[model samples]
Target: MQGYKKETELLTKLLLEILPILKAQYNLEEYQSKDFRTGDIACMKSLLSRLKHLKTSKFFSTASSDEDLKLKLKVDAYEKTAKNDQKVIAILKNKEKGLEQRIRELEKANKEAVALKKSMERKDEKLREVMRYNTVLKAKLEC
Candidate 1:
């Protein structure tokens, strides 16, 4: 979960940078005031479709190849973060399994404690009866 959180954070930061470019493209399409043609809706739609796909992708998908070395470095960071996230998830899952096993063991011990308590109560009752019988026998002997 923590890994997922970190991945989400990093993706958010990347999106923050990409959003303005996407917005510029959207406005350009809406106004059609640039080199882009009229039937650019297909292109825009394709871009949006890609965006949707990238939303789920862990490798940080993008619509353009205009990425420079710096952006590529960020992409690489995203890649490393994703790999670390997988490792964290694996570790957490193992820890969860261990915790579940420990809980089961504790539950078994608790059940055993309850059974022991019940047996001890029964033994206490029998002990009281024996003491009472011994007391009466002693009185009779004194008489």
Candidate 2:
């Protein structure tokens, strides 16, 4: 009886760890389409099969109300995790938009500075002509 209890205890712990982790990994973009790796799928399937077997056996009843209570708590936790995931995704999207706008503003400022530099270069040509004219007049007066 102790051996059976220990086996189920270990399996229950394994089940507790597997379900949420598999659910999270399965939803990732890399696994969204036909891109899901065979190995990951196989592992998930194995875990699910074991979980099903554990839940159905007489051994499951050994823990009685404890298992049922734990399951309810785990489900509640998962529900809250879903909401948190959505909030995180929304915040990330907002951050990305802000970063993109900042990049556009920086690019615009760079273009305007370049244009101002070209305008100054054009004015510098005329200024050189005026300086030359003044120097010639000064030399003529001295002579």
Candidate 1 ranges with C-alpha deviation above 4 Å? 1-66
Query: Which prediction has the highest TM-score against the true structure?
Result: 1
Scanning candidate 1 in windows of ten residues, the lowest lDDT window is 30-39
Model 1, C-alpha of 128: deviation from truth (Å): 1.2
Runs in model 2 deviating more than 4 A are: 1-64
Which residue pairs in candidate 1 have backbone atoms (N, alpha carbon, C) closer than 3 angstroms, thus clashing? none
Across 1-143, the per-residue lDDT of candidate 1 in tens digits comes to 89965654554444445544454432423322121233344554555476666556544443245355236545665676789899999999999999999999999999999999999999999999999999999999999
Q: After superposition, how far is residue 100 of candidate 2 from its true place, in Å?
A: 0.7
Total residue pair clashes for candidate 2: 0
Summarize candidate 2's per-residue lDDT along 72-125 as a digit string, tens digits. Answer: 546656776889999999999999999999999999999999999999998998
lDDT of 1 at 121: 99
Clashing pairs in 2: none
- Each candidate: RMSD to true structure? 15.0, 11.4
